[model samples]
Target: MRLVTFNILHGRSLRDGQVDTGRLAEAIRRLDPDILALQEVDRAQERSHHADLTDVAAAAMGAVDQRFVPALAGTPGAAWVPAADPDDPGTAGYGVSLLSRHPATAWRVLRLPRIPFRVPRTGPHRWPQRLAPEEPRVAVAGRFATPEGPLTAVSTHLSFVPGWGQLQLLALRRALAAVDGPVVLLGDLNLRGRQPERLTGYRPLGRRPTMPAGRPDHQIDHILLRGELGPVRLVDNPEMELSDHRPLVVELGARRG
Candidate 1:
């Protein structure tokens, strides 16, 4: 099965600071993933033209099932004001999402601990930092029927603060342990290398750098696997240019009889 993890940066392209649904859809089609884990997804946001990015992505990829979990109720990088109307089409939210070609029988959203207060120097310093209060973060998991049996896929966007991400990772590991069958963890973890394996005991499937899409140097995005599975291979598509981070695709072989 082909699994993909991407931080879409709210579907805004680096080339043009605009969220083009058509462009986003085309990019996802190129990857053609069986299961997709996405972060920084916008839902009913004006910036994305009040479009439900997760829905757009699901339709774009023709997913059989999909789920989105909002970490924040309002738009990111803006004031921490409540949405005037929660059901309003223009009410904005930021979160993570999962889409699968196979139907999901079960699903859950795990809320992770967030730092009580923001640090002045947190996150990548290159970009402008917003001082507004931030929303809580979360991870979403789904169970799907596969030829090899039930496989649990979890999608998350962890904290970017130093040391804080590790704490969130620990919470994720605990939440996933209760899931039955094999587990596939996908996300923009913000932490790199063997640390995830050390924290969660799930082996990393790929070691390619995915951030700063044009010239990546850190392997923050990942696909981690637990339980028995065949050899995995990374599907590199350097031409993908939708988000600031490059999408990660990996092919997992079915279990041998």
Candidate 2:
């Protein structure tokens, strides 16, 4: 099976500062992933041409099943609110998504709580600067019926705040305790290096730096597995035009059905 995790930055190419769906689709096609997890996705938003970016990605990858869980009702870097529900049918929203070529048998959602206060922080050489309030984040899971048996795949984008990302990861781990079968977690954790592995005990299938796509120096995107699966046949971080991070792709054996 070939699985990929990518943070598309809302399909905006940093090169020209444009949201070109054509380029996004082409990149998805080239990866040709059997299962794809995407973060920082836009839907019915003016920034991304009012197109359902998750749907676009699903079609691009030829995924037979998909789930987009809206984390915020508004836009990021502007104005937005925590979505009332996971399946927020709002005209405009942003969140994470999971797509699979295999049939899905079940689905689950987990909302990661964030810091409640908004305070300004100062750097070593700069005065205190108040940043935008932290936004709500979510994780979407899908249990698929593959030849290997039922496997649970989760897609999520975690908090960037210090220590908070680890808290959320722990919460997610507690929530998955009730689920059965092997598990595959994929997304941008914002927790670099081996932090996630140290916290969750899940084996990272790949270890290539993926941030600042132009010149990646550290890894924030990852593909982690909690249970047994086939050996890692190939692992790659495919360079693409959209997003600030590269797409981390992993392939295990053939017949990725």
Candidate 3:
């Protein structure tokens, strides 16, 4: 099947300094992915015209099933706020999303706690209180019933801080351990293309870099499969200059046992 992992940067297009839903829609149509994992998606941000990105994206791609998990919440018109409303995950400025053409059997949001530590006090920073709370992070996981069987798809955005992201990565690996079926992990891992030994249970598809879209010298965004699927192909949708990171497409077919 054709699966895609994209960091939309909240649907902001690099071609223009604006959040254009149409451009975002067009990109999905071109990719024609059966399953999609999106990062930096805005659920109710005023900057995005308060448009629900998951819904808009589903409609744009004619997807029937979709789920969104916000990492933190934001005010109606204020996308800058970093506060997360315990009452609602949708208000979060950032989130991860899963969209599929097939019906979803179940869905869940996996919240990953940050490592307890203080930011270096020597550098210029934002509000004083901002640095105290645990750096928020989350993963959106869902089970999609395909013709073959139930398949799990997970989407998440890891921390960028060194050592900190490693802890988050371990948390993600543990979360995946609970699933007992075929699975695919997709997201912006914030890992520079080096080696996979730091993490466990899966392997990356290819070695192409995806960050700084212009240069793309690192492969942070990734798609990992569980079973011994047949040969995997990595897709680079280079024409869609909608975000700082390039979108990745992975093709997987069943393998013989």
Candidate 4:
């Protein structure tokens, strides 16, 4: 099966500095993900032409089951409120989405911890030190009846703050304790390398640099496994025209005999 995690940057292509739905659809169609997790998705926003990006991705990949979880209600980088309803898709908000071809047996939406005020930090190519305010982060989860068996998957975007992301991850781990099976986490974690593995005790299924789509050096996007699965067949980041980060694709050998 192909599992993918992508930070779409709201479907705005850096190549042309515009939000093109057709471009976004084509990009998603290429991955052909059986399970897709997307961050920075916009819903009913003017910037993206009032497009329901989650619906677009579902259609592009032929996914019958999907959910959009908004961390904030309203427009991103502008007026908005911290969205508490995980199932709410009507509000104009930006957040994460999970789409799957298998019918979901259960669904969950979780709100992650975030820094309420601006914090100073050094960015890769950004200013030496810039105060940036982080929007509320959220996660969406679903349990599906796959040919392999019942699989549980969670997708989330964590805080970018130095130590805060780890804390948020820990909180998320606690939140997901009740899930019936080993969880596969897919998202732009913002925490790189063994950090996520060590914190969640979930091994990384695959990894590749995905930031700064033009020339990625740091791998912030990931697909992690909390329990046993088939050997990883392949892992790669496909170059795309949209978003600052490339999409991470991982192919697994099989479920079991």
Task: For residues 115-178, write the lDDT of model 1, one tens digit per residue.
Answer: 8885553456665455544457788899998777789999998888888899999999987887
Per model, how many backbone clashes are there? 0, 0, 4, 0
Q: How close is every model to the real structure, measured as TM-score?
A: 0.91, 0.93, 0.85, 0.94
For every candidate in turn, the CA RMSD to the true structure comes to 2.8, 2.7, 3.8, 2.1
Q: Give model 2's TM-score versus the native structure.
A: 0.93
Clashing pairs in 1: none
- Model 1, poorest ten-residue lDDT window? 80-89
Q: 130-188 in candidate 2: lDDT tens per residue?
A: 65677888999999988778889999999887888999999988888778978999999
Top lDDT: which candidate number? Answer: 2
Off by over 4 Å in 3: 75-93, 115-135, 194-197
Better of 2 and 3 by lDDT: 2
Could you tell which candidate, 3 or 4, scores higher by TM-score?
A: 4
Report the CA-based lDDT of candidate 1 relative to the real structure.
0.83
Q: What tens digits encode model 4's per-residue C-alpha lDDT throughout 1-257? A: 88999999999998789999999999999999999999999999999999999999999999989998888888875688888753465678889999999999999888877787887756567775666567888889999888778899999999888898898899989998877776899999898778999999888988789887999988889898988777799999989979999999998888676
lDDT, model 1, position 139: 86
Residue 147 in model 3: shift from native, Å? 2.8
State in Å the error of residue 38, model 2: 0.3
Residue 153 lDDT, candidate 3, scale 0-100: 85
lDDT (CA) per prediction? 0.83, 0.89, 0.76, 0.88
